[model samples]
Target: MNNNFKMIAKTLFGFEEILAKELRNLGASNVVEGVRNVSFDGDTGFMYKANLCLRTAIKILKPIHSFYVRDEKDLYRKIYDMDWSAYLTADTTFAIDTTVNSENFTHSLYVSQKSKDAIVDKFRDTVGRRPDVDIKFPDVRLNIHIQKNQCNVALDTSGRSLHHRGYRTATNIAPINEVLAAGLLLLSGWDGQCDFLDPMCGSGTFLTEAAMIACKIPANINRKEFAFEKWDDFDEDLFDKIVESSLNKTREFRYKIGGYDKAPSAVRKAQDNISNANLSEYITVERENFFETEKYTEGQLHMVFNPPYGERLNIEMETFYSNIGDTLKQKYPGTDAWLITSNLEALKFVGLRPSRKIKVFNSHLESRLVKYVMYAGSKKAKYNKTIKE
Candidate 1:
């Protein structure tokens, strides 16, 4: 039986393409990319696989219905008309998440309230009982997206954001988001071919993500649960089979991946998190200042890290960035170093030219992922002309 249905995977800015490619590679049919999201067709088993394997997705939503809403009353009526019993029971707790971008619906809170009312009233009128709203940990979560007059009602299949990959209980002051870390690694063309390094590794997010990517491990192999597990029609045996199949596809990684942090606390935290992820055999973490240390590998090295962006960390941006450039140029040869920072003004102080600069957002702050290529031997001396953005 063909039980395929359309699903949407939400992602951060500049990751739509990578998410789309991930969807296609995961056997999604008719994959389509939208702004900050990707739509694809898959079955229930495929959905489980996607939530487990996709590294760049924030959430996977299975849209159940779509309609045009004239007003709040119309929206309520449409929502009330849905067969809520198919998804929720009187004993189940539910939550409604709303995103609005329409002239008619200016406030998402109001939309959520109206949708909740509709669902509650429907249950009350028919079954004489309704589910309670539990925002923190709901048995079922629904998403209502309003774009102009069109409304998309979806079930949140992967709850609590897919970035919570059941690892990293500890974090630094300004830890990078796991989804963003994975996406940045993918954008940098990291395929685990060469030795990998995260110089300013904080809580080892990049290191964990890099190891997973290198070994072809499912992104959420350690995740405890998915929202679909709470669904009425969730098939436990099928999900278990999917998990085993995904694990069977994992490949062995031959290259070494490690991290270095100047701060002893950060190094300890990184080690703890890496150990929690069970990637100790594939990654090494040490307390060492990145600026003072040179490349350890004789072959080409791929470095990715999120240094202190100067917002939460106290440091002179210009001097820090200048030292970064000097160390890369003087010591780290035959390496491709990629870093993301919100301080654009300080990026100019790096002195070396960036081969590529991509616009990305770290939470609310706008940032750039810049790549610098350090050549080997005398060829490094030839990189005199600095390319300006």
Candidate 2:
């Protein structure tokens, strides 16, 4: 029997292509990239694997139905007409999350309320009871996306966003999201081939993610639970087999991954989080000012970090950024350094031309991930050659 079905993996802006590539590598069929999303076809076991392994996905949604509606009345009628018992029981708890892009449905909250009432009324009319709504920890979460006049209803397979990777229990201020960190690392072309570093590693998000990628470990291996586990049709045996198989595929990582932070507190937190992820064997954290330190490793070095991006550029920030360029150029050689920051004005002070710049978002802030390549030979010789040219 063919159990294949369509599923959508939601992701942050500028990650659709990455997500699509991940899906294809995982054996997804008919992978298509959409704006901030990737749609593909897979089975139940594949769904489990996607939630467990996809590093760039925020949520994996299994679309059940789609329809066209004229108004709230039509929406309620269509929703109430569907067989809700297939997914929900009289005792089960569910929640509706609605997104509105249609002019007819202006308010999302009101749409959710009306849709909830429709489902509740359908159950009460036939089953003599209705499931209660649990907003925080719903057993079965549903997504309603209305674009212009079409509505798409999908079951939320991975709940609370896959960014909640369940590894970092302690975090510093302005910690990077796990998915964002992973995406940035991929964009920077870090494939666990050589040494990796996060110079200003706040809470060690980059360190943890880099180690996981290097070892080919599943992204959500440490997560406690996924929303699909709560579904009535969830197969424990299949999920267990998938988990074991994914773990068996992890490759050995021989390269070293390191992190450095000036603050003692940040170092401790990073060490704690790395230990929680069981990656202490492959990663190390230390307290050191990035500007005063030289390259600790030999050969090609791959560096990615999220530096402090103050709201507005000041003299202090300019000097801080300038020091970043000076340290990279003078102390580090044969290194590919990448950093993401929202402070575009401060980036000018870095005094180095970026080889590549990609537009991304760190939460709501529009940011840029820029890369600089430092040659291994004498700086003066390179400068002289350029001046002569």
Candidate 3:
């Protein structure tokens, strides 16, 4: 029997297309991109694989039901009417996560409370007992999304956001999110084809994600657990087979991935996080000021990094950005350098026309991921020629 079902992979703001492509490449059917999300058809095994492999996905939600409600009373009535025993037992613990976009349901916390009461009341009436709510670490996590008058109820297959890849225990003051790092690398078109570098490599998130992508390794391979594992029907044998198969698909990467940070403490933390991901064999971290260093690798170089955005650090913004342009233009050649920063005004000091600029967000801060292409020889002539063309 075909066990195909719809699943939604939640992602960051600008990663809908990337997530859709990833889903298609992973053999998903009917892949469709939505705003900050991608929906596809997959089975149980595919669900496990998506959680394990999708780098751009924040959470994989299996939508169970959707309905239209007039108000909180209707919402509670509909929720209470559903057969909760199918997903929860009297002894199981569950949590409801609500996202509200409807005028009727103004407060998400209040909606969650109403839904939780419905489910709890249903269980108590039918099974003589009700499952307790565990907010932090629930066995089965449920998603409630209200858009206008419609409500979508989905089971959260991957808990706590897939960005919690379980390998980044040590981080600097403002470390990039793993999903954002991976999405930026994808957007920059870094396909593990050549040498890679993260010059500002704070905590080495980009380095680890780059190495994993190069080697075709699963994104959440190091994660301790997924929310689906706590489900009552979770098949250990099936999950084990999926894990082994995913591991078997990992290929050997011959290219070098390197990271550099000026601070010794940042270097140590990056190294430690890289080691935690068991990627020391493919990545190296060193302490070096990025502006003073020249390109050490030959041929095409792919660079992606997140520099300080002046939010948490006290630095001269204009000079720092100007130095970035100077270093890339004078020292690095035949390199495609990409950086994401929220400092738009500081970017003007760089003085290089970007080949591409994509709007993205670094957490709540609106940011831009800009790319600069440095020609191998006669930088001035090449840039002028391109501009003239």
lDDT of each: 0.94, 0.94, 0.94
lDDT of 1: 0.94
Q: Residue 209 in model 2: shift from native, Å? A: 0.4
lDDT (tens digit, per residue) of candidate 3 on 1-389: 99999999999999999999999999999999999899999999999999999999999999999999999999999999998888999898999999999888899999999999999999999989999999999999999999999999999999899999999999999999999999999999988999999999999999999999999999999999999999889999999999999999998988899999999999999988999999999999999999989999888999998988999988999889999999999999999999999999999999899999999999999999999998899877888989999
Whole-model lDDT, candidate 2?
0.94
Clashing pairs in 2: none
Model 3 lDDT, full chain set = 0.94
Clashing pairs in 3: none
Candidate 1 has a TM-score of: 0.96
In candidate 3, stretches whose alpha carbon ends up further than 4 angstroms from where it belongs are 379-389
Stretch of 10 with least lDDT, candidate 3 = 374-383
Alpha carbon lDDT of residue 29, candidate 2? 99
Ranking of all predicted structures according to TM-score, beginning with the best and ending with the worst: 3, 1, 2
lDDT of 2 by residue, 182-248 (tens): 9999999999999999999989999999999999999999999999999988999999999999999
Q: Which digits, one per residue and each the tens of the lDDT, describe model 1 over residues 79-162?
A: 999999888988999999999999999999999999999999999999999889999899999999999999999999998899
- Of candidate 1, the 10-residue stretch with the lowest lDDT total is 380-389
TM-score leader: 3
